[model samples]
Target: MTKLYTICFLLLIMAFGFLTDAAASESSFVDEIKNTNERFDTRAVPLARQVTEESVLAMEEYQGGSFRVLARKKSIERYRCSRCHTGKPVTAAQGLELTHGNIALAHGTEGPGLTCIDCHHAQERDYLEDKKGRKIDFDHSYQLCGQCHFRQKRDWLGGAHGKRVSNWAGERVVYNCTSCHNPHSPRFAKRFPATYSVPLD
Candidate 1:
């Protein structure tokens, strides 16, 4: 009977000790909650302000000084277009398809349909020519696009349209228009909404 009492008493003491420790922990946690204003200052947190080298491709100056843009000519498959172009006119014979037969020209609107030679330089296959016959580098193709899309160009220059590849607090690396939109089509394809609606019975 004494052994049973001793075991029961020890168990009760242990339970009380555990409860006390738990209560003390809760009390400390509550005290911590009460002292919330004395916590570490958010302003002291370090921020990533510098843009990494990989984040930039090429930098150009606009009205707001220098900004970065993704390189266009670097991304092209057959970049230095002079390889097979040969600067000769492509006159197709009966049943003879041109080399770039895959490129379906869907760029312009109502008119006598725009041919490849209209935008591309006839004599210089490596360059795109403006309406004034000035040579435009593939990297600066935005100049050609801006000839018609002046409004969007204006917005792009003003940082209203287009996107910046850099984060909130780094070098301003703006994306070229061709980054998001296809130069040939430019129209964004219709995509399904992210949130699926509940099925109505």
Candidate 2:
């Protein structure tokens, strides 16, 4: 029985040794294949050269404002409101401050008691918050506005409302609600047309 046990132990040890050797061989084989592929890739593809000032200028010359449409978010000088209001929490009592005192809330005749946080996200100052508390990007702010003003949203989508940028023949890039109408005071301010000179003799 002792002799049998000794033989079984010896067989087990041999099996473990074989497995370890096989694993090591497999790992080495994989590593070799990886190294070979890496070497081939390196040789096949040339390293990209650093873009110089002259190259940049040349590229800029070729690139025109043909396809690119001007986004209103880019025009906003003070976009990130949280930069100043980082520590400050938005409150109703905090009325109109010195920073945004001039903002007239003349959007809806009955749309009173509306605060900044009503549209703007509390956590994300850059994004607008929907009724469902979903973060809407400043670029796609129309989505947030669409929640209440579904008619205008549909009109804008159907190319009825809002001004379309550049050529109307190709890609249609229209201005957002915030572009024409201020988020705080969405009503288009009453502006009188310039008087025309009489051409009668």
Candidate 3:
């Protein structure tokens, strides 16, 4: 009986030792995997270069140049307004009631008293007419707008009004008044402000 008990105790001790060894081997394997993953992550990440003011200035100097404003007439997809109105004459008394019903001439301080022929050339139909009846190309529509709103034109030329193309430091290619303001209804409609993601409080 004593010998049997001693054998059982020895067997229990051996089982415990095997379990501990297995546990130790598993721990080492996990640590090795973790180290390999860390090494791979470090190798995969790219190093970012430091951006300096001098580098930015140098880049600006390289790309900087004078650029002319893009012509609006060339940009217009549907420029066939004159195609239909070539033979037909727009009377100042009748106004644009039949065809131009979609157009809401709510622009300018003059109100509804203003007519289509006031700005548009009645004779040419293709080109815009200034207050002096001079034919102004659609590309140079700014000249026609400047005839009445000289102050706005001056501000637009000085870079106060309208959006600029590309960067502000580079070429000064600006959009015409017609780009932002609609020729028919220049007044912008009122709307609710956009919702913020971050809490104000």
Candidate 4:
């Protein structure tokens, strides 16, 4: 009986050794497959890990932790809207094609819907307006967005909604609404996954 037990144990050890070899080969194969996949090519791209306070960024203090968001005032292309938005401000209902050129406003529901004037100050072309009739700075457009998307705002404040800066540590810098969502057309269209696994070649 003891001899039979010893034989069974030896067989079990042999099976484990074989499985170990198979697993090691499978792991290497998976590693090679992953290395061949080139989803995002950031080899030559340069990205800043920590943004300074001087740059177009705003330091935010929340209950969870503190972080920074990109400021819009200076970074905006056609900033100081007073530059060309002079005279009567062009409304979205107007000839947006002629004035803004290809700004398709497709958000909001019927009746008392989202219009340029709803968010943007009627007179101040640069500053945004909240539901409370307060002027929101271009840097803090998140405030204006929060009026409608309270849940998302809450999640963002709690570090759940938006993504943090890429490969970040120490001082956390998170992306705001405008970073991912287009204020004009907030909803995202269907798209392919950023990455996926492929069969070994």
Instruction: Say which candidate scores most in TM-score.
Output: 1
CA deviation > 4 Å runs, candidate 3: 1-67, 74-78, 88-99, 109-112, 195-201
RMSD of 3: 13.2
Compared with the true structure, model 2 gives a TM-score of 0.55
Model 2 Cα lDDT, one tens digit per residue, 20-119: 9999999999998877843435556444332221111110111223222235566577777667667675575654465677777655568466777888
**Native-vs-model 4 lDDT?**
0.76
Rank by lDDT (best first) = 4, 1, 3, 2
Number of clashing pairs per prediction, in order? 0, 0, 0, 0
lDDT of residue 173 for candidate 4: 68
| Candidate 2 collision pairs | none
Cα deviation in Å at residue 16, candidate 4?
A: 30
- TM-scores for all candidates: the values are 0.64, 0.55, 0.55, 0.62
Top candidate, metric lDDT: 4
* Poorly placed runs, candidate 4 (over 4 Å): 1-48, 52-60, 88-96, 110-112, 192-201
Cα lDDT tens digits for candidate 1, 53-162: 33344434668677766667776676677886774665656322555555666778568767778778888878889899999777667778788888998888778898
Q: Name the runs in model 1 displaced over 4 angstroms.
A: 1-61, 88-99, 196-201
> With candidate 1 superimposed using the best TM-score fit, by how many Å does residue 188's alpha carbon deviate from the native?
1.1
List the candidates ranked by TM-score, beginning with the highest: 1, 4, 3, 2
Checking candidate 4 for backbone clashes, the offending pairs are none
For all candidates in order, the CA lDDT equals 0.74, 0.67, 0.67, 0.76
